[model samples]
Target: MNELAAQIGVEVEPDYRADESDPAQSRYVFSYTVTVHNRSTREIQLLSRYWKITQGNGKVQEVRGNGVVGKQPAIAAGHSFRYTSRAVLASPVGVMQGSYGCTDLASQEAFEVTIEPFRLATPNQVH
Candidate 1:
């Protein structure tokens, strides 16, 4: 990872939405809140997103899109942007990982901030 990528931090908190999930029908709904922190001295804008989702049943899904939650947010130095998003899986357990495409506002330099793999599981699903 480049210096710009190293300066950005990504954190995710995932929850299983039992109300929206139907286990009998093999549908599992999960909501994850992500916070992107800009640790660099320069302002940065999130340009796009890339995600990889893997299910316990050995299924994988890849998603790529512009911005997140419908907006390309510009986060100032030492600031953070947070958003909540949803994902659906056929299995009760899964993992989600991705990267954010960002650009430094001052220099227009582009980089990717890694989003480490995080668990997505129903209550007591993973031990």
Candidate 2:
């Protein structure tokens, strides 16, 4: 875990592989597993998510939506939730970063939880 990961109380682990469907296109598919923990005493409701996805060609896409996977997770103190998502990039190298909008159930006030940027690369780009 790193500092950014610690700030969000979440850990992002990425697993990427070459896209067999289009080997010559340089496209790669990546899946990230996010584990978020509620460290506060109050229950937190994840209301929305914002993501910035960049392709190898320098094109960027921003996605904002209500919750993930069509479900809002209410996490209690010391509890955690996890979700898996996929992304496709034009090149084997790119990154994804985002934040989660969460509200304290007790206060009804919302705050953004940062989701650290994670890399997507092929075996040759590992170094």
Candidate 3:
């Protein structure tokens, strides 16, 4: 990974939305909060996002789009940007991982910040 990419940290907190899910209908809803840490010296703007979602039933879904939640945010150096999003899976358990395409505000250079795999599961669904 590039130094800028390494310095750009991505952390995720996922929760299963039991109230919004319908297991009998094969609808499992999950909400995830993502925090993007700008540890680099220059301010960066999130340009795009890519997601890989894998369900317990062995189905995979890939999503690619510009910005997150309809906003391309510019995060100052040493600052962080946080956003919450929802994902609906066909099963009670799943995993998600992806990366962000960002650009250095000063240099206009682009890089990718990786998001580590995180689990989305209902209570007691995974031990």
Candidate 4:
């Protein structure tokens, strides 16, 4: 695909670490590893990120940051950037969705690439 096509791919692996989670106190800690792949034909630099995190209790949190894990990675054409991040929630089950702010190196145009919504649930918390 082309830059104007703006096709970026994302993969997320979310895990619930019971050792670090205190479900009894409503504090759940989850870590997710994201693999961002550049499916388009142009190189792109990740500028920023915006995340919409929702707790099972219905509370929503907006996280705006400069980059993923302190680095704004540049994904060359047909390449990928992978990073791991963590999140804390007030409930056992929650959902996170957002996008990455990126710029096309060839045209200097900016775009938002979607990070598909993923679930964060402690084991046995959801059936």
Model 3 has an lDDT value of: 0.94
lDDT of 4 by residue, 1-31 (tens): 2344357888999999788988789889999
Clashing pairs in 4: none
Model 4 misplacement above 4 A: 1-5
TM-score of each: 0.98, 0.86, 0.97, 0.93
- lDDT tens string, model 3, 1-115? 8788899888899998889999999999999999999988889999999999999999999999999999999999999999999999999999999999999889899999889
Pick out the ten consecutive residues of candidate 4 with the lowest summed lDDT. 1-10
- Top candidate by lDDT: 1
Q: How many clashes does the backbone of model 1 have?
A: 0
Candidate 2: residue 13 Cα off by (Å): 0.8
Residue 66 of model 1: what lDDT? 100
Q: Looking at candidate 2, what is the lDDT of residue 90?
A: 78
lDDT of every predicted structure (CA atoms): 0.95, 0.79, 0.94, 0.88
lDDT of 2 by residue, 4-81 (tens): 223348788888854442548766788888899887767889999999998766889899999988889998878899
What TM-score does candidate 3 reach? 0.97
Error of 4 at 9 (Å): 0.4
Between candidates 3 and 4, name the one with more favorable TM-score: 3
Please give the TM-score that candidate 4 achieves against the real structure.
Answer: 0.93
Candidate 1 local lDDT, 1-127, one digit each (tens): 8898898999999999999999999999999999999988899999999999999999999999999999999999999999999999999999999899999999998999999999999999743
